[model samples]
Target: MELADRVESLTPSTTLAITSKAKALKEDGHDVIGLGAGEPDFNTPEYILDAAKNAMDQGLTKYTPSGGLPELKDAIIDKFKRDQSLVFNRNEIIVTIGAKHALFTLFQVLLNRGDEVIVPVPYWVSYPEQIKLAEGQPVYVKGSEDNNFKITPEQLEESITDQTKAIIINSPSNPTGVLYTKDELEALGEIAIKHNLWIVSDEIYEKLIYGNDNHQSIAEISEELKNHTIIINGVSKSHSMTGWRIGYAAGNETIIKAMTNLASHSTSNPTSISQHAAIAAYTNSEEEIERMKEAFEERLNKLYDWMMEIPNLSCVKPQGAFYLFPNVSKIVNQSPFDSVDEWVKQLLEEEKVAIVPGSGFGSEDNVRLSYATSLDQLEEAAKRIKKFVEKYSV
Candidate 1:
């Protein structure tokens, strides 16, 4: 039987692909250091886990309001008010299975066939695929590496057409870890407003920022911008709650209602116990979160320095998040390999170090290395990578 066209065209996620290969090799007793994982190495905090246990003990395992538990929505509302100073009523929010699901549902409800969504290049692996799944066309706007992999307002302005319905903005981006400054956001928001386009702001990594960089939502810049933007966020990265699968979208009531209605026939609601745990995640003290951020910062600093010492490699210093995207085209050109994907493959086979090739992320010259693992492992991975580069690059 032939698969559906939508399913047929979808490329498997390269992040998951590389991670799975590393796991398989490890199972065979190969000493594989997988730097491809995008999750925090730390376990979910004790307080959040305690809340889940309490929730189960209270028999809070039944279905909830299709949108979310009221209290959970209130908690999310409070979080917005606290963090970004943005206000939203409960009806304007819809709890989703994850931030990914929130984006998928938004596109599903917002796009008809052939509608175009402006996607900045070097985006997360899922964005283009998700857009295609919703029968929407993804129009790519390249974010040049010299600009810290961020697209300029002129570029965004030039990319829009009447068919352009929305644009996605992921700060502290998945592969690059680049944060958009407030000024940059305002410029982009101005263009978005001019074009009357919806802004899908993915801030899932907001809490993982490093150094002095602060995260500012475009929606928070103005009431006008807020009216047109939907913020996608969750506790997955912030609270190390990836397994909980609880995320939310906050914005206009009409869109939220549509997402909720679609979800009613689909996921129904996020798992009840996980909802309770997410409440704890937002309400409780963030000391544990701060500690995790500190660890990631240290790892990033050391790994970045080590990576730079390797000949013919270059990278922009990331301001937030836990991943480093390094351009390896120079070394690849000098080496026996013809492409970054081949170099990545042979690096894994010879040195047992796994990293995701940037071809999957729409940039051919770079590869993404996650610093979400142990310092020792990152150090070792750096060594192995340097050794491989030295061996091959004449």
Candidate 2:
């Protein structure tokens, strides 16, 4: 049977594909190193797991409100106040299956057929696809290497059309891990206000930054900016709770209500057990989270240094998150490979190292390497990559 036309037209995520291929190879007994997976290597903290056990033991296992449990909402509200100085009532927040689901649901609620959403390239792979699923056009504004792969306010302004309904700002961005400063966000916020567009701020990586700067939510910029922005986040990246699958959105009550209604008919609620676990994750300040962040920071430093020393390759040093998007045009030009995808394929087959190609992330000159693996794995992967590049690249 044929699938829906929408499903047929979508490109499957290369990140998942690469990770799967690597796993398959490893299962076949090959010494494969996978750098395509995005989740942290850390386990869920003990305190959070204990909270889940307590919830189950206390018989809080029934379905929660489609929006979320009141207790969890309260905890998330406190998290916003404690971290970003943003305030939201319970009506303005909705717990979702994951941050990815939160974003997908928001687009479903916000977009009408033919409406446009401005996505900066090389974006999180799902943005364009989700917009398409919502019958919205994804209007991509090209991000420049000179600006650390972030779009300028002028670039954003130029991409808007009369049908532009919203713009997605993913600071501490995925893949690149570059962050936008407060002033930069303020500039973009003003443009959003001028255009009367919704700002979908994906701040899932807020707690994963490696620099001196803290995450500054665009919603915290001003009162008007707050009203126009929908903040999407979760404990997935921050607390290493990806497997638990809890995420949330904070926005205008009307939009949030619409999204909650949609979720009720679809997911009903995030897992009751996971919601309880998330409450605990938000309620406490654990040193374990800091320890995990430190480990990622250390891995990032070692990986960055190693990558720089490898010839015919270069990448922007990431300020947050654990992935590195390295420009491999030097290698591509010298080698027989016509694109980064081909180059990545050969590397996987020959070196047994898996990396997501930039072609899937809307860039053809680079590949994305996730450093969430151990130092030993990264070092070995680097050595394999260096040998491959040296043998092939001019």
Candidate 3:
């Protein structure tokens, strides 16, 4: 069977691949503790579920307009104004199947062959593959653990070239869970303005932040930058609605229109029921969100402290998101295995704990462990990970 040449250049999402492998082991009767999956463990809040049920009862199952339902788009506009202190017109927003779909559409509309997108290393696994699928080149700007896994404005400035079309800024980042501060964003925004680069701000995990740190969207900095930025967000991480398959983007009218046109042909509008439910998600009080955030913070602190207790298994304290990306290079070089992948494989085989190898996220010396499961599962998984690390220590 001949697949499209574009398909040949893309790699499967490493995070999802790890989740699938963990599920397979669980089905095989292993007492596997998976720290690889990235969704919150909490059930969708009752109010949100009720909204979906109500929408169905109201016969909102029919297809919505290609862009999205007006009510939903209005809700999104209000959300931006209320939460981020940013404003957008209804036409500036387009709901898609998920944040992933929004991103794919953005790439298709903006990228031409050989255009380069500057992505920081240890990025979400899908960014590079999606860029490649759009026939664009992904130029990685490596961020080290010493700097808390964040790319600096200096790095961004150095990475720009004639072929450079855009840069992706994933705050409260996916693999590392680090959030970029307002000043940091402003510096990058200046660079983008100078060089005419589109800032694709992936803020899907914006509401899942921990501690006193706030998630700052690049668009919130100024209207000029906001005009040039495409903000991708959704109900997946924030509302525990990953399966609902709804996400949206807000940006300049031209880009949003292009994305909507592409979406019209590909997936059409997002599921009508989900769009209605999303209206409730965006407009409702955030009490449920705050509760979930507190729970994630508690679990995240526990995981961080546990990882710290294990000698030679140091990790940066993630300010946001439900993940802890630890630099395990010490263990990698000392292990009997030849690579990070082999070490993770052996860890799973021996300890029945699942984690994503760092190599999968463009780093060879680290691994990502998600704490989005229950506290009990997190505790058990941490214990197993500690024991496994102890066995290999000199």
Q: Cα deviation of 16 in candidate 3 (Å)?
A: 2.8
The segments of candidate 1 whose C-alpha lies over 4 angstroms from its true place after superposition are none
- Candidate 1 on 213-305: residue-level lDDT in tens? 888899999999999999999999999999999999999999999999999999989999999999999999999999999999999899999
Number of the candidate with higher lDDT, 1 or 3: 1
TM-score quality measure for candidate 3:
0.98
Q: Per-residue lDDT of 169-257 in model 3, one digit per residue for the tens?
A: 99989899998889989999999999999999999999988777888999988888997799999999999999998999999899999
Go through the candidates in order and give each one's C-alpha lDDT: 0.94, 0.93, 0.90
Off by over 4 Å in 2: none
Q: Write the per-residue lDDT of candidate 2 for residues 194-236, one digit (tens) a residue.
A: 9999999999999889869688899998999999999999999
Off by over 4 Å in 3: none
Q: After aligning candidate 3 to the native by TM-score, how far in Å is the CA of 225 from where it should be?
A: 1.1
Which of the predicted structures, 1 or 2, would earn the higher lDDT when compared with the native? 1
What TM-score number comes out for model 1? 0.99
TM-score of each: 0.99, 0.99, 0.98
Name the candidate, 2 or 3, with the larger lDDT value. Answer: 2
Return the clash pairs for model 3, or none.
Answer: none
